[model samples]
Target: MHLQEWLQLLCSHTGLKGSESEDLWSLLPSLPSFSLSTSSLLGLGALASLTAYWLVTRPRPMHPPCDLQAQSVAINGDPNCRRSALLKDENLLEFYYDDIRTAYDMFQRGVKITGNGPCLGFRKPGQPYEWISYTEVAQKAQWLGCGLIAKGCQLNTQQFIGIFAQNRPEWIITEVACYTYSMVLVPLYDTLGMEAMVHITNLAEMTVVICDREERATSLLENKEKGLTPKISCLVLFTDFSQAFAERAGKCEVEVLKLEQILDLGRQNLKDPVPPQPQDLAVVCFTSGTTGKPKGAMITHGNIASNASSVIKILEGSFTFQQGDVSISYLPLAHMFERMIQLSLFTFGARVGFYQGDITLLMDDMKTLKPTFFPVVPRILNRIYDKILGSVTSPFGRALLHFAVRRKQAELRSGIMRNNSLWDKLVFNKIQASLGGNLRFALTASAPISSTVLSFLRATLGCLIFEGYGQTECTGGCTFSLPGDASTGHVGAPLPCAMVRLEDIPDMNYFAKNRQGEICVRGPSVFKGYLKDPEKTAEALDSDGWLHTGDVGQWLPNGTLRIIDRKKNIFKLSQGEYIAPEKIENIYVRSVPVFQVFVHGDSLQSYLIGIVVPDREVFVDWAKEQGFVGSYQELCQNPDVKNAVLEDMRAVGKEAGLKSFEQVKDLYLHPDMFSVANGLLTPTLKSRRTDIQKVFQQQLSSMYNKTAS
Candidate 1:
């Protein structure tokens, strides 16, 4: 019988909801479908019958109709890699099929579809995380948008809102509010020093600043008072004003608005829902330039939305997101990698938990949160590996783990055994249990991961590790490693959203037809250009709109891409900090008593190395003051003199406003200076980077080993 018919007959016979039946509560309000006045009124027999029928009658998990036009994508070297399926949307879930018009629109739709469902999970210090339902996020975002408009802040392209805060629920809420009001979001890294904060805000022409702490607010207002910035009208502080900045706050001309005050002011604006168009600028993200100035990348709403859509299309059924799936986010939202992934997961109704401010507490947060999805960097994964290795006790236990790891590695390489092994049940299961036994997948970016580490994590936690390749300009992902594609060397195949082609860089000995060159990308994911810097915009984004990534790449046998080298001098350190050697050298040579300086770095290494040629007079004077009775060459060889020079160099870097990651950690003082005659510098007085690296190869090696030891 039909559900309605069955209900009607049951009610009529039992007199549970009928007028003739004994009334459980006569004063209760009535509804047409059923009465929820009391749970005891519904008998166990009725509930059991209903549950049994529902379970048996529910539809099985089904695959969508096949697409005849789908093609195969190949990766060259790895035979274990399965031939990837083509542009096949049929296999995608219902969420992927929707043509997401705007970010705000998708957010509201998510709210309606997932009623009372957890969209965001937040935790306080010394407390467990509590789920914030979709309704609450939507309501709060709406109110926040209204509050923004109610203030002097305008809801148009002319208005730029600076978000100077850590990664938290409030950050996401502020982003959503920006989308609704069509205001451009200028994200400043919370730990970014004062100069960058002042530079970015002034360049973006931010009218209102929504910051989490008083120090940041004071920094912005102080910059204004110093005449570095023209004028900022409003300051929205998320935290209380501390005594540290209270004096500055009182003297500042800008009006202060509390977050709660804005919310209350927005209570009257629930119905004003003006969302941004796809073409409108959503963000002006500033990336550090090699010249010590920050250049803002203008990312539009369509750029971000399209990039997310393309990723979902390529990864369809390979990665599935069920409702209530918990995702623990540890990366900062100021960067595009974490920001775009958060939005994509949100659209599919996953519960996203933001990590607390302290990174050491990440494991504790994960234990309490029990996350199924984790977005990580290589450092985080390496730390977890270290922890696991430390926990292994006896030699016998270590041998067993090694054997199990080898067995799993062989099985994966051969593509023979797809089932879980006995090791998982006997030993590896403990790692899974520690992570709440639910970590299904993890995504890593910014740098390449060790294949050994990758295999160990896959075997230990039973989770797929997907590593991707892209710049901030590409909206976080251009090529993505697929499930079961444990290919070596290369990251993965290109997504349909962007077309990647290798352009010739003859100076670096790479060419396009050889299947390797400068990695250039062109698509909807590419940023419009560097904000307000048309010259740089022209150089990076030409007439055809292809972004010159400046990183050398090669294609694998199966059509995947690998970064072989970087033609550009800038490289990322192990901790994901970008270090431009030339930029550092320029700042140091001007202040330090150095005739010439050559900076070198390894992406797989944590710190920087400096090769210096100290000035003759300054070096002798400093040595004499320190009572070093020797010639300049002898003084240069002295360890004590080297330490003093290193301290002086560090002071130069500090005064020049370089961040800790950008500063030189170690140095080698040589008596000989770099000159054009020595083949280290060109006739134009530019230091030949490759030549310098080769000349001081031994010195660089010694410096690296000193820190390692």
Candidate 2:
């Protein structure tokens, strides 16, 4: 019998028959044939509505679809030469500051805007930071400039003032003094070595050398005695000097004056400032030479100002600098990257606290200052990540930490970043407090950071951390990641002052048509040219004003740049395959057992080799796990330990999709780290490839001989 008829009869016999039941039976008969009952149909309708609501309210992607897939616009129908996808009219973004054309002008604007606000900061090892007001800084700068003039230093851009010091208030003061007086400032650091220092001083013909310590002044006098830098006529010491040093300076025919003396001279002489024009050379920044002599990059007032202004505009919506904002300065001022950062901070009237000249004390400085902004490199961030993860020893603690990270990452994906969530309050608050408990933004640059570390820190810190890419030639910034970008490996679109393009690197098999080639930058930020090296300048800057960066880059569909290889760092193997040691090193360094790695490839060989400095603690832990115990140095020589590390590296390389030729076929585990102190690393922590190779020549040859046997 039909179900509808059966239901109707059953209702009638049971004395349950009514108009409502009859209508229900009629509706069931008219309903489309289905096994689902009326209740099931109602449940399905509710589920569909919920699904529709979810579809509409779900979190959108961080970047637009076009940004994720579209190619940058090619210039003049040449796919090889492209600008950012955001540009349609092909015009670069204008400068953020309309009137500020020079760093001196920017500083003056800051003095007017922030007035008596804290400008520079200093502190003892254990004390809170002390601040210098903007007005005081301006006054000091003027006095110093006048003093320099009174000391017979020329009052024009031709006069080069050499500053040999770490990051300190005195260092910045000297810089501003140079800027305001139109004197060229040349920074000297320990990493430059005596030879490079002598080279730089003589090349620039510096008459005055301002140093923070007595030792620096003595060193200059000694160099004068050796007749290496004879043009150095005045020694200005920021610290108190001894009578013996004064005598030494007198014998060297150099006038010795204390910083206070210079200030007093300036106070008596009081001259008006001679601020430079836009095109005037602001600084002669020398690159940290890893293989050859350092080349001084002649950065103009407009080059640096425009770069800073462009960065400010790009980051204004996300990281607006305020008078109340404070930054810790630990990175070397000699490096263009840090100098550019400080310049931007000064432009916005922010406070900068100098670290205690020791990297180990950086966190203590941060804790005392409670800095609002942090500019860092991957090495430091990696250390922080390792320390934080290592501290959670308990299984429950690890689980909870992982859970919190996952939850926060989900929120990040949903376009919500919070420092007040339940997970944050319970788990990540402590982590945030370790970094001064007040960090609102941070930046990582100079090297690529792992996505795992980046994501973890983004969730734990509950603030924005941007990655930037540039060289000294471009005034330290070419491109920077957007504020909320969650992706990794790509340094974001070009800054407003930078017009970036890609050219075919045919030798490296990189083609711009394939969205891969050498990165070329054009715009106001490009340097005036390498100081005194026209041939080098011509090679760097093409006829069309594109500065060809030696970095090999692949353009992402999102119009972002991913630095893939170093065109100059590539070497051919016996099999005719090109191997980029830096590219392979970047991957193998991700192994937990590896702390620092350098991959080496010889043209005569068919395979690559590596010299790895393992993370001491982790390596020891693994050794103990394997029931072997020894001192770190002894274990480094153990064959078993060597094989284990090699295997771990292999696993990491495989996971990273490294080709067989790219993977290290043999490994040498070194106990000593490649450090700047050892002359194996540069001031920026980049490996001095030639120096490292020289240091490990014996090991390298032994490994190759063994492989051949």
Candidate 3:
């Protein structure tokens, strides 16, 4: 049956007459009832029905398994189903879960878990690398957990431990120790300013803090005047403590320990067993608040374990990992996505490679590790694609490159590559070399990447760049685009353990067919609740346990998910027509020549905009080649540059199928780009819309007031 027909049938049979008022309660009447005595029977019946449906609808392999080990359990049922069940059952001994408890247990069982590795820990230009194996990690955690207990860390209750540090092995060690001690790990983004850092630390009521270096120690010490709580009694650094530096600090004083000192304590207390439950609160990761202050989302061990197992199962069929796969760690571990990925890597016993310092050396690190998997934001992929396009020297070269891209895209769509064209081996070979030539898969999130970018990546790289969608509240990944199921612009199917439903706000002007609406999710991976904010927590999680994701999304025909924009980012024009700034901004930014677009005009008749940071290098080269002489600044202000940019915007707008009202009527170009230091972007590189609006308020007003050319 056709997709529309299937949807219509489901709607009709389920009594969902329209998008509005499609309540599950209305459909419940047609289902079987259950009394206390018959509830088990009813559940079994429902499970059987679901299994049958899955067997009929789920995708099957073209070739049957020759060996039993090669065959995976079906999504529905089979003999291997018991193995799958054992993997998910919390009570089962065979359950190899992904959580701090599992990590601790693995360490106790003599697994060589390394805290400091050549890739992630402290490294100098020409020094011998230092590392701490799994036994040491377990030993250190036991001591730290014991130290916390000795220093008044209690059990079966919520306690906070602030982890303030850069990406380091000690960060994970501290977090694991917190879990072992039944304390909540509050991960603070190291790049956060003093105010946010203090606010979160205090809000979480952190009793102890583990700092990565002297800089974090100084931040905490300097900010002590703002009233440090008595509960926070310890300040430990990964580096050796300096008594002189410690004496300079004044606040609610606490005992300080160096990394080695803490480990020494743990080593002495190695015989003690860690105390924690599967249901205990494990970590409190903060959300990236684009609109307001970041909120701490409480995640439990069960949540982590369930989510990780579900992800592992989904990836098992395609992306298999052995005992020692290589992963390069760079993304902030404070972010839930990175944290989840780290846990997965550790649980799978993968070798993690750390970058030198920042993303500038990511290419070098990728070459060093030759990693099989990496997580990145869309900006990184887009930049790489731009660089690839920029390298082409002639019209014929560009044509051949485009031809290779198109053919490769066709192969991806058709899943058959009968024609082994020479162009792929010759022209695309260089593109593959740029990414270290060993990238198997990449996971993109934090923003929407353009279909053009996604297509280019898959074609040239010969690997699937899986697009995942989730937020800090959902533990970073809720949906992922599967291999061979690539869509032009979809986030992909709902992950195995997640249930997704769109709540249509038809009264609002932005609703589209299977399109824009609040994305609601119910899954084990969802947060327990927002910390210390019950009202906000209630507002986000409904009574039925569905988390209102706040972002708007649509289900494509192929069951892939497409994120349109954040519901909060949508602003109305004078005509009451809402404009999704992110969608529009993504369209403009993907034009290759444009960079950093901000769409504004909250009360204007039509949207007016200002864009900053053009691809000056690319455009300047183009201008010089065209015999247009002047500096980049002179060229930016040149009539030709303005005309070219405006034309590019129009072309992109038309291609994206945006309406006239949604298009940018007038725009002002800024010479400088937004950056972390400029207070224009978040640490994660997301535009601070409110801050941008306030900063460019005058420029925006002028653009709107002035008539378009």
- Give the TM-score comparing model 3 with the true structure, all chains together: 0.80
Model 1: lowest-lDDT 10 consecutive positions: 62-71
Of candidates 2 and 1, the better by lDDT: 2
Cα lDDT tens digits, model 1, 656-684, are 68889888888898999775456565322
Worst 10 residues of 2 by lDDT: 62-71
TM-score-wise, the better of 2 and 3 is 2
Could you say which candidate leads in lDDT?
Answer: 2
Best by TM-score: 2
**What value does the lDDT take at residue 123 in candidate 3?**
42
lDDT of each: 0.72, 0.84, 0.67
**Residue 690 local lDDT, model 2:** 93
- Using lDDT, rank the candidates from best to worst: 2, 1, 3
What are the TM-scores, per candidate, against the unseen true structure?
A: 0.70, 0.89, 0.80
lDDT (Cα) of model 2: 0.84
Candidate 2 local lDDT, 272-368, one digit each (tens): 8999998999999998898688999999998988888877766664458888888899988988998888888888888899998888888888889
RMSD of each: 16.4, 9.6, 15.2
